[model samples]
Target: MARGRRLMARDGVRPSYDPAGPDQALRAALQDLRTGRWMAMRALLADTTQWWRWTQRTQILAAAAAGTDVVRAWLAEEPGNVHAAVMHARVLVERALRARRERHRRTHELWIEAWDAAQSATATAPRDPVPWVCLLALAQLDPEQRWEEHRAAAPEPMLPPGPWGLLAEAGRRDPDNREAHHRMLQFLYVRGGSGRLAEAAGYAQWAAGQAPPGAAAHLLPLYVRVERYRRDSGHDAALDLHWVGDEAAREARRGLHSWFENTQRAERSLSDLNHLAHALWGSLQFSDASRVFEAIGPYFTPPPWMYRTPDRERAVEIFVQARDRCRAAADG
Candidate 1:
């Protein structure tokens, strides 16, 4: 009878409690989480759980959400189960999300901790979408740094060519998933540094129609582009350089501007023009920059930018200087 019971215990799911070394902290974290005993989990990882350890550093945080303890004991018992690992990560992420909703002064701090835990889990398991999911969450909170990291470190190209691709596949698998939509939206309207604009444009079109109302804030610039591209037969640098497509190729095919008159009717976003102007200036496309300045000149009032806040403040000054330079060169 004792032998049979012991054998049965062997077959049952165990929690991660590996004591071999620090590298097995994520395993230990999963173990702690399964035990439903937070104290035990804390004991298992005591002294070993240090910040930037990245593995043990962020485990069993779901305790706040799950209202369980004994995360450490669970790990000591069951060390190698991938399903458990995923479950543990999900719990933490959900908890993090919840915390973000009812946040107070310490909200960003909790989010940071949760993000760290998620990233650590992702680093441990690269292929799983859960970590990517969590990292995507973190991107909202710290996108400038986080997206830069994802773009710099992603295993694939910043954006791939195939349909049902990274952002597309995420949208398809979870259509109602705000996360997938939000991430791809961010991918579409990237401001600066290492974004693949062509792929970003593809994501914009794929994301345009059914992406969700929450994407409205992001849609303004893309809408204006789809508009400008349609009306401006002469301004095709983006289309020509990347082979994005003709203006007729846009999903809605509605022009943003009227060729009969040079006025723009859409809601204006100054930050969009600021980024566009800088990008064009960098490429020596003064004509494109001039068009951008002319189109968005009506709304160039003060506002904040995600990356280039200061530079955006100086746009009128910069545009004035550029305009004078172009005028001088044209006559000379």
Candidate 2:
């Protein structure tokens, strides 16, 4: 709407990589963790009741706390604390993944340590899905599928065997766990080749189908579409067609209905919101995209947008253009 545009312009709504969006408590907790303090992280995790929020906050905090001894200190101060134990696994997994990215010689050792921590956390915090998600995170680092559990048979013949057992454990603890599905997709990507796209797409559809109303799982298809686009070497015209295709539109609509419409704004994943907005805008569902853009506010994840352009500034420009056009269309 023109009103929406004016409000956005007046407020200068810009994209940011703010780890804590609309959650001041998380922001403060992250700050404290960065300063090597664990109390705020401790309190925040204690107060976070929602599984999705718990999973998200722990992963974010783990990333920030990985370089410090905050998690270790917390564990030492409160032995057998489930939150600290799970977070220790998360930080170790984060370190392992980072080591893998950097081609560090210690990657395998870190991965094994992370796996052990996560496995221990599962016993300590059986009802919490974060530990299972932590194990799923490690699944990608083992591309050879060396672990028997990682080579579990796929539910459908079309899909490849992967860490389905880890995913199932996460789902058992928290159905439609967002990070768990994404971790599986990361493994599929590591599998490499055109076949990876099919695996990812099939996996996305399977997950989306089982998703309940208000679950972030509905956005999986949109992410797969982006992955496909990223893999394709097509020109602008072909890429445009890919985005506005029947299937793309259908996925966007399903996400809007099954997830966006049913979930509260504060509860939505910032990454999921960005993907939904990107898909809706790409599919020419401007009105629907406008709503998603509004929900996104200033919180923007690099992903799905960065897939458009490798240049950070260009990606931001593209994001802003799509958002403005959607707002204008809704207004008209």
Candidate 3:
């Protein structure tokens, strides 16, 4: 069993966030769609839809994250394309989120536009969970009371009646949708007050238990942990790995053994691997941490690593050093 231990930084210089390079495939796909390769883009979306549903959803989200313009153009070219509609709604919701984060003056207007797009998508693809997921994400932007009033006033309540209703619809459409569950967890996190973080943790644990064996949903608790740490460590210069408790270590170990170690599909998500590596390193399982680092290779996600600092470059630097230290200890 791995005992809990702190992995300290070398050189005593903390790192900061710098924008990382774009994912080439996602970038290229967005470019292709934007630059008149409509047939190719359609084929690509079709191919993704034929893949594992989770992968399809993730890829759609990735494409949507690239930009709304390409997806909008696709929608205009093929007005009845369900994929285009869903992606367009997702992009609008993402833009709404960005506007909220940046404190843009027209944030509410963006949210309304997102809500409209999501509703249209839902109508176009009644069986698709992706549109419901977008609606749930959009609902999360406002307080429940505010959203309730908005929903009541809306011509058609863009989403299903309520947050739970939207979530249930998403689940009904696809029971194994991790993104849908994640959206609910975020909703709960946003709604809770002083005990919000703890509530989020409880929800995460429950969701993980409800998920199929070896599913990535087991990693949800780690996300909660990262969020909690980020909130508590506000403006702190360095993150003390010791902040991660024994229970979290045990849970991380269980998650690794049950969902990560034996599952071939776990390789699809570098973010999950990064979280696992961070947990294992903090728990003094250097050898296990080393293995995860080997899997991660050149890619890094800046969440739990940068929970202390918003700097992506600094996060990558610390991640590399920590991985190196773990590998050395494991090899010795």
Candidate 4:
């Protein structure tokens, strides 16, 4: 077992939170962005055709580019280029979000700039859903839903009013967009209250129920589950039952059958896979969990695992123990 652990470490079997995950092209693109080159980014975005992949790639690229002027340079070099224009919006939005996180004095000003850029991106790429998704992302900064469009009515009575108009616009361009729904859920989280969590859970169920098989929207409930756990005061004592409960098991199995089984190996979201793997492991579904662990390979998103324990090292220990147990079960 010690030998196996050493081999695993040497083979890079430990979990990582690399944004690029297994996407070598995206990793290279990020490297290029850091070096003040935009060509690689342009090529990467150009090749991303699927709406879900486009949202994921743009988000990762935007975060990487927000710290630099590469995206602005891209816009300057290719004035009127729709892709560059959209990417410029992405970078602006990311910067605005970072500013908000840091409580920068210019948060409001930056938010307006992001909103304008995102609104412009919609014109630049009328058929693309990403710009609308960007708008949805920014909606979190406005907890009151001050903008009339931001306070649009929910589709169902139980759900609260939110930035549903922005969500609808994204859906219009690309129905059941995964990131868009997740962004909405984040907005619900920002409006923190006991009731808001209930709203988020309801919204997750609604989104998951409406999505087609294999849609990333199926992962929504698992995210809400984690959010609930994170907010629970007595989580330590209730942790085991919280995960292995009937509802948790149902959510895990539903996501496995609907999302994992239906998604192609290359197209799966690393974060989604991590959440599914965590959910299944927590629910004591080791046999099914092992398949997800194998699918995850060396990548890790720390949030799901980190929630298991307050001690960061202990969290990693839990992750390793679960992974090894799953692997051992599979070996039989």
Q: What C-alpha lDDT values do all the predictions have? A: 0.42, 0.88, 0.67, 0.87
- Comparing 2 and 4 by TM-score, which wins? 4
Order candidates by lDDT, high to low.
2, 4, 3, 1
Write model 4 residue lDDT over 248-268, tens digit each, in one string: 999999999999999898889
> All candidates' TM-scores?
0.31, 0.94, 0.79, 0.94
lDDT of 1 by residue, 37-90 (tens): 444344443444222222213323443325453332454556564434544664
Give candidate 2's error at residue 85 in angstroms: 0.9
Evaluation by TM-score, superior candidate among 2 and 3: 2
Local accuracy of candidate 2 as per-residue lDDT tens digits, 158-258: 88998999999999888888999999999888863224787899999988998899988899999989888887734555777768889999999999999
- After superposition, which runs of candidate 4 have C-alpha atoms over 4 Å from their true positions? 1-12, 192-195, 233-236
Off by over 4 Å in 3: 1-27, 31-39, 50-68, 148-162, 192-195, 234-244, 265-267
Q: What's the best-to-worst order under TM-score?
A: 4, 2, 3, 1
Rate residue 217 of model 2 by lDDT: 88
Q: For all the candidates, what are their Cα RMSDs to the real structure?
A: 22.8, 3.0, 7.2, 2.1
RMSD of 3: 7.2
lDDT of 4: 0.87
Off by over 4 Å in 2: 1-8, 192-195, 233-237
What lDDT, from 0 to 1, does candidate 1 have?
A: 0.42
Which 10-residue window of candidate 1 scores lowest in summed lDDT? 251-260
